[model samples]
Target: MHLSFKNLFFTIASVFGIFAILILAKPVLIPLAFAFLVAFILFPVCQKFEAWGANKIFAAFLSMLSLFLIIAGGLFLFSTQIIDLSENLTEFKEKILEIFTDLTLFINQNFSFVPELERGELLEKIKSGLSNSVGTLVGQTFSGTAAFFTGLITSIVFTFLILIYRDGLVNALVQFFPENHQDKAHKMFKSVQQVGQQYLFGMFIIVLVLGFTNSIGLLIIGIDNPFLFGFLAAILAIIPYAGTLIGAAIPVLYAFMSYDSLWMPISIALFFWVVQFFESNLLTPKIVGGNLKVNAFTSILSIIVGASVWGVAGMILFLPFSAMLKVVCQEYIELKPLALLIGEKNYTDSEKDDKPGLLKKWGEKIKGWF
Candidate 1:
């Protein structure tokens, strides 16, 4: 029962090697992961249909169809609005420039000993920078759009197949382990599914509420293109704090540019602040219900890391992935310490007792092996 150094080294290397592969394969895997996530989100609806006497295949098909239609309709509606907004960009830029000029003049008029550059030169530089930035942004947008459509098509096809043959996939995975471990494997799979489903459904509801509430508020504040801004905000809300901050900037900037009065932008900023306060304090808690036990700090850190590794897809996928990892660690005795480290204290009282501290357990194992 002696543990060899060679064996330990091999184990560590293997883990690292797998991680490397995952990083390298991220581009290919992103669509598949997205498909699985979408399927996971739709699982409850499929289950409800099944409960209502429909077969699994039929239920899945109906759910997918409904999702497709909703997405298509939203895209169609938004496309027209986006085109109109793009067409008015010249006017928007002019308004923004006027505001900038006014601010510059105010600063020069009010402040003493401030050396002022020629307004025309400054404006020209700003315009040149903005033009370059816009061109770069447009190029990136075209590339991103192409990538998104490609991923979307692949995800849709894969999701349909996955939903259709989900049972077979489970069975195949179960077959990978020994006969005695099949039950454990099944249990683990169930835990993953439960955590994923709960997270996805809860997040969906929360994001929808956020979008609608913000949209309504913006409309009330007389913001142009409220629906577009609100929708973007809601979608960005999926990324946690960063999403809200970025989402707020759009309307705030629009308010500042669209109106001559500073009061309007100030009011809009206040409105966004209130909406965000409500989301964090009220909506998130009521909807998500503390199932995701990661604290705010860890949640943000995980999102930043995930987004870095996987781009936007990473950010969206990271939350549920972390949740699933926590669930697995809680279920497996050897990995319990990891669960404790990743999860909030409120979510893991039983796990604390059931799973020993990681270092202690590892030390004992090493000693026993020797």
Candidate 2:
């Protein structure tokens, strides 16, 4: 047996084993991943502080302080929005009940197999869902307040430690490579830092822009609570494709019920479509760049896999992490094929039979032998 094949099989098994370990150690690793992202974003700022003669610990402390303030401010705004929205619970309930009733009626009218639901029973279900959803999300997902705080504090501490030991971390990673490959390993880490900063900071800018645009559009369309819905949608866009759809769907629904004419809903839908189009092609392209380097299919697949492994954290972290993996792969001759697999570059027919394509021909040859 060729040594190369043995190495390939060992590497594949190692990857599967690592995945199992990740799932088993998720409670610890998830926070660490979050910390790494935070440290990446804060790296430059920490450097400046260090350059000014601040100790690593103090530099990390200052950086973490600013991050905390920004997060607290955002949360405060969200809390206020929720509070104000709660004041309109009665109106929201009526609107929800109306939509539910009409939906049930349509279903019954369209489907012969469906039993018709009375309006009273339909309203009861809708009300129950609305009341329980908030509790379920906040309580069940976080598994109570203690777990949420633990993760938050853990991430913060990890970020500080990462920022403080940023250089040490890089050196530690480089040590894993042979002497001849040490330079490439260092370059890979540098590229990952650049990717992380570009991806995360660009996302922040895009979110702010989307929030403002969504709010202005909703205001023009005369939707109630435009700011609340707009920013909420904008924030949701952080979740990628599904978030944007869900965000727009909320206002579209509100517009459907708020106005007498169908034009209002149509207008809101069209507005989001245009905004999202420009966001993808213009805003994201300009700000985020091709840092992720993966295609849409890979991205959506990562989200599914990430959600399976890490839940919400996976969906948010996996895309960037995949890009990081690609960077690391590109640094190694043996791993370059894996990098190509991870990337989204279009290939000509001639390129299709490249090194990795050997596996395809090998499979076909096996069939001939069979």
Candidate models: Cα lDDT each: 0.78, 0.80
Least accurate 10 contiguous residues by lDDT in model 1: 353-362
Model 2, residue 292: C-alpha shift (Å): 4.5
Best candidate (score: TM-score): 2
Model 1, runs deviating above 4 Å: 1-15, 47-59, 76-84, 97-117, 125-139, 346-370
List model 1 lDDT by residue over 1-370, tens digit each.
9989998999899988866876899867888888888988777677677778888789888989889899899889789778977987889988888669667867887783357656677678778888889988999999999988988899888888888788899999999989999999998987788667667767777778877888898888787788888888888888777888888888788777777888878887898899889878766655555545466666887788778778777887877788788888887788898787777764445544333333324334643332
Position 235, candidate 2: lDDT? 88
Q: What is the TM-score of each candidate against the true structure?
A: 0.79, 0.82
Model 2 lDDT per residue over 139-198, tens place:
777675687699989998899889878889899989998999899778878888866766
Whole-model lDDT for model 1 versus the true structure? 0.78
Evaluated at residue 67, the lDDT of candidate 1 is 92
In Å, residue 115's CA in model 2 sits off its true spot by 7.4
Off by over 4 Å in 2: 1-8, 75-80, 105-118, 121-145, 257-259, 347-370
